[model samples]
Target: MKIFELPQTNPLSANRTIPNVDSRGFHYKDFETMKPEDSKLGDAGFYVGIKATCVYHSQTERIALHFLDFNTRVLTMRTHYPYYEEERFAKKYLSKAPIWRKEVATIDIDILYENDDFELAQHGVSCKDKEEEFLTQKVVRRSARDHEFYAGINGTWEPVVKNYFARKEYDNYEFILKHIRKSNVLALNEEALIVSQLWKKRGLKRPMDSLLEPFARKIGTDKHHLFRLTCVAIFLGHLRLDHKYEFNLRTPLRLRPDGVYQFSRGVETAPWGF
Candidate 1:
């Protein structure tokens, strides 16, 4: 399913207004009380924002739902197990919050697992081709407006976690998983052997200028080498190297930087099991 439909919204009619305070407390007025002309959708004279967030696991195609009412600041995040009873998964991942702010929204959503197979077969597949179909699905109809608003925001949570990962020092699979869970970026195996291998060999202390010559030689005549090098640099940066020499060993030979290199003092212990 497309990422955009994960969150869906519907405009409210204009005639709607804040429910009058009564002996019980404040509550929304009934839709029946409003006039037909005033009740037209999108005419809710005042702002009443709603949003829904759904994270889709690329590998398993599972989805987790996070509902938000921008107007009231209420949140209801839950998971539905398609293959099993909804309550089964609900007890584990479902969260109920009356309010959530943008600053902490990413953290809240990150904790929900989007790869639950049972959950995917039930909710994920229903919206596989038409994400907006959830709007009509009774399970999500009550929060359609909220979901739409969330769709409008469009996967902002992933980038936030990725940014955090980009700033940290790379350690092991656990460290990567911490950010990966939050960002939903990389889908490496649990062991992340490739990353571990690169991490182990990344401690060599060669001069940058010397390394550049060999890299340039290996990259000779390949137009795509530049693009590959750029990707390598980004991945290396996420690994958090203090010096350029540390990157040379981890980077593929053809993609190494081809320019002057400066060496810094003080060697840090590498974490890879070589």
Candidate 2:
């Protein structure tokens, strides 16, 4: 339920001028009309990513960080995730599985809600009766089944909320950014279609190092090329990882527990402008 903090309606300075028009067009005098460009924080890109759902010209032509929902098996744009990765705020949450619409009226009515345009539906069950209703819709953990952590303005806060699943998700993206080079993503040009041929339906858990040299030799490609592709596969859910642990040559990977392959369901959606 926590929302992002924006500038107050009345500025502390007497000499500053407030504009009549804001980026969204005509607006009221409330602090709600702010553009983050006005914020004092030096890391504008950090806050911008939360409030605006994007960063300007993120250097993605080569490599872009992306988030993959473990449950939905969908990859969202790099900007589309919670700010804080901590999950302690979830003290109010409860474990619940997805339910059918038909079963809701007769059984569970506590967990569902609607989108403003009604064009989108979020299917999270939280902070309420496990069998009767979903409790706290205001805030939820992403790892929680069917919950959209970014629901409402909850994700754009000043001190980002702590979310475990969100952290894990971000961790996945962060690891790629720090270790994998843009040259690697571009040079190999590995796509889901290419990765699919790997470890297909094996559902076998194996160390990352195990696949590298062999797959490279099998496909007649370089080990470095095949390794980066494997990382991409991990992010796209063609393979699964603990994520809480950092990636290394020895990282353990297994088929998604569901034994279902997302194929390219999420990775394809990542914005790689080039």
lDDT (tens digit, per residue) of candidate 1 on 6-26: 321211122223334322231
- For candidate 1, the per-residue lDDT at 166 reads 15
Per-residue CA lDDT of model 2 for 36-153, tens digit only, reads 3632332224312100133312222001223212222111222222223224223323334433332211100011111233221222212121212223452232234222333442
lDDT of 1: 0.26
Winning candidate number (TM-score): 2
After TM-score superposition, what is the CA distance of residue 259 in candidate 1 from its true location, in Å? 26
When summed lDDT is taken over every stretch of 10 residues in candidate 1, the lowest stretch is: 159-168
Which segments of model 1 are wrong by more than 4 Å? 1-203, 221-274
Q: Rate the local accuracy (lDDT) of all candidates.
A: 0.26, 0.34
**Residue 175 CA error for candidate 2 (Å)?**
1.6
Q: What is the TM-score of each candidate against the true structure?
A: 0.20, 0.39
TM-score of 2: 0.39
